[model samples]
Target: QQQKCKQYMSAELKIPTPHSDCKTACILLGQSLKSDLMCQFENHIADFMDGLIEESMILEAAPVSAVFSSSLSDKERGKLRHLHPHSQGKQFISRRSLLDELFEVNHIRTIYHMFIAALILFILSTFVVDFIDEGRLVLDFDLLVYAFGQLPLVVCTWMCMFLSVLLVPYNLFHLWCQSQSSSHGKSRLCSWLFGSVYLIYQTLGLGFLPTYVVVTNSFPPASCFIIILEQVRLMMKTHSFIRENVPRVLTWKKDKNPAPVVPQLSQYLYFLFAPTLIYRDKYPRNPVIRWSYVATKLLQVLGCLFYTYYVFVRLCIPQFRSNSLHLFDLRAMVLCVFNSILPGVLVLLLGFFAFLHCWLNAFAEMLRFADRMFYKDWWNSTSYANYYRTWNVVVHDWLFYYVYRDFLWMSQKHFRTVALLCVFTLSAVVHEYILAVCFGFFYPVLFCLFMCFGLMFNFIVHDQRKGPIWNIFMWTSIFLGQGVIICLYSQEWYARHYCPQKESSFLDFLKPRSWSCQRPLMADS
Candidate 1:
């Protein structure tokens, strides 16, 4: 029986084929099996091995196959399907948030409790300090009030943006679809009509309007951030809606099919409020809303807000607000950056926990959206590449699908490195825009870090660097990056308020004001 099985296996491999994939699989399977058991179950084993090879064998190229792969055309190479499991891109599943699952563990819960205790201590220390200084405990939220000023305008601006996004994209697409049934010339006219309107809406309506309002109003950091962040989110959503749907429209036109029914108005509206940037006719949803979970997450968000305020007031204010340090002096700047590291790291943690984890999860729960992976365990990332991917997975998904993959598809799967660089630049620019608008300056520190260090680390310190030392390296880089950002931005903020440029130039706007301001040019607030 063993001899017969061997002959059958040999015959199977000897069959003419385009490639040796199945032959290799068959050989490996025969060698891996127990020799003693193979004699008794030789026929069965042979059959099983043959079936496995048929199912699993695929044409995949590796380093060794580069010589052969080089001869394939760009079109052919782009069409080459990867059957390997690891090659598959993101597959989102309905699951609990990483933090939600982690908190169930006693060890993680204790760490959470420790943070709560620290918050309590901060509150007590503030009360005691205020009482000692003023002979009464001060409870006024002057800082919070100033930071969140012009709340009404922010709400109004967001409404206009959201309403425009909701109406403009969907209705314009509907118009375009209706036009498809008309004469070719008429269809072209309608396409031009709605297409131009959509472009104007995207450019003037979503892009310039919110930014103009924020800058014109001289909005405080918090208020400016709200408008800017919402603007970016809506723009991304609008793009995703169009990008994901336009292909279907084109396909219908190409196939000469009846115009497909447009996306339901309800679906578009739900997507506007949904946590995800990707548009779909439907999404995985929970059977019921967990109101308790929603409430808990929202409360955590509030806690983080207060936590940040305290950090800025206690650590940042006392240090940067001092009358002593020169804003631009080398020694002073170096000291400021190093000293700011602790608070910078704290604020970083707060921002991640507040927005990405608590805020997004809260909205997801309220909406019954079940794909709860807003972020992964980015803190455990040993490489910056893993850190970037794991950090804020929601945004990464949008960039990956719309920006990265679309670039590949457009470029015919060539210039992968170029595509990566473009993606990095766009991300950096958007981030810099956020900070530049919110803080009202053009420092470019974050942009430099992203483009230089970030792009380099993405290539160098990839997923393979899993040593404990790499984790330390990752943390150190983040800490220093955050410290420089906060220190430089804080200096610029104070400099702008203190040293109001009596008159400004294009150069002044382009240059960082913190570099020249040595002392207050205006009186204290």
Candidate 2:
């Protein structure tokens, strides 16, 4: 039987007699036995030989032989099929960002050096001006200090949010899972009751508690930002946990014979702190935590903070400080817009570096999470579409998975455009909400730019326009958009402060004070 199997395998596979082996024949036969092929050849030796002859004839009739198909294109050879965008899988083992690899190149390293040089020049210029104007080189960081004030309260709030996030989701999910496994009616009912109560508690703790603190204490913008950002992070983390695990619990409830797999609390806790937004049972991790690298990233974050302070003080503050509302004509607006471009771009870059790179990398290293792809080469993108998808990959991943992809699935893949619109709308609303909450106002400048101009650009200047000019256009748009946001928001911010209304009303609060800062001519007369 073994000899006959070997002979059949050799003839079917077109292997030479000299190279034919029993082990290979046995493996092939084992596979066949596990499949329907075994049934066709089960009758006799004649049947097996007939099947092999048919297979060989089919192989010979093919246009291209597998052994000599090098002339074929990758598509023809089925080699590049996986390269298709939809064919690619969403989740995989983590890898470093493209910029991290580029930093190893000499040319890319030069760019880093250039940024350092610019920082040094800014420092020197500040010192020289201080010495010349005041006959002293005293450095004041009062703005920076004020921006980051109320640290103890912020820390306490963050700790409270973190504890709630760490404990609530896991415990609720655990209870649900246990209830799913239970056979008794009373136990299941009790579990449901406990879960409902726990969820309400979580809602109040995660949502209302933070907002109450921020509103009651009249937290500064920066301090409010800390609480709001933490709230967002914890909410996202909890949603991800529920999204990933709940279906499994439901599935297990249906099939109660086999035990369900539940991830450990340690794994969930680790995921809460991990840089990536996706939840997983386990993630690729580094063998050792690099303390030096962590320290360097932390320092870079600090440098970025200082960089933002300097840019605002030198470029933004002075531009808006002395300008009266009556003097804010078209010329003033144009000048302010142009002047804001440099500082706005600098702030954008510093923010991208500080949070996406430095802050994420620091946390990733500390946690030994090997995947560090927090961002991509968004600068090189020629379209706003690509820019949105590539920039802030962490958020993009979550939005794509939870919002875009899930919407498509729910809609049975019919409403693709609607799904995309939903994504854009959600993103725009979230951005506007964050800004409104942080700034304590309802300026929808970001919303207008994002939903209107940004959405238009996404379709108009798309990924198909692959040229240097298109890239330049995209960058120009980015600079102008940033300038407009900085200029208009800064102006409104100052206008509110300098020209407070006699009595605060909802209409007055919602109104843009910058537009009506100067009283009516009749009132003045």
Best by TM-score: 1
Worst 10 residues of 2 by lDDT: 63-72
Root-mean-square deviation of candidate 2 = 10.1
lDDT of each: 0.80, 0.77
Q: In the order shown, what is each candidate's alpha-carbon RMSD?
A: 10.0, 10.1
Error of 2 at 272 (Å): 0.8
For all predicted structures, in order, the TM-scores are: 0.83, 0.80
Across 365-385, the per-residue lDDT of candidate 2 in tens digits comes to: 999898786876789888787
Error of 2 at 149 (Å): 0.8
Superposition error at 429 for model 1 (Å): 0.7
Clashes of 2: 0
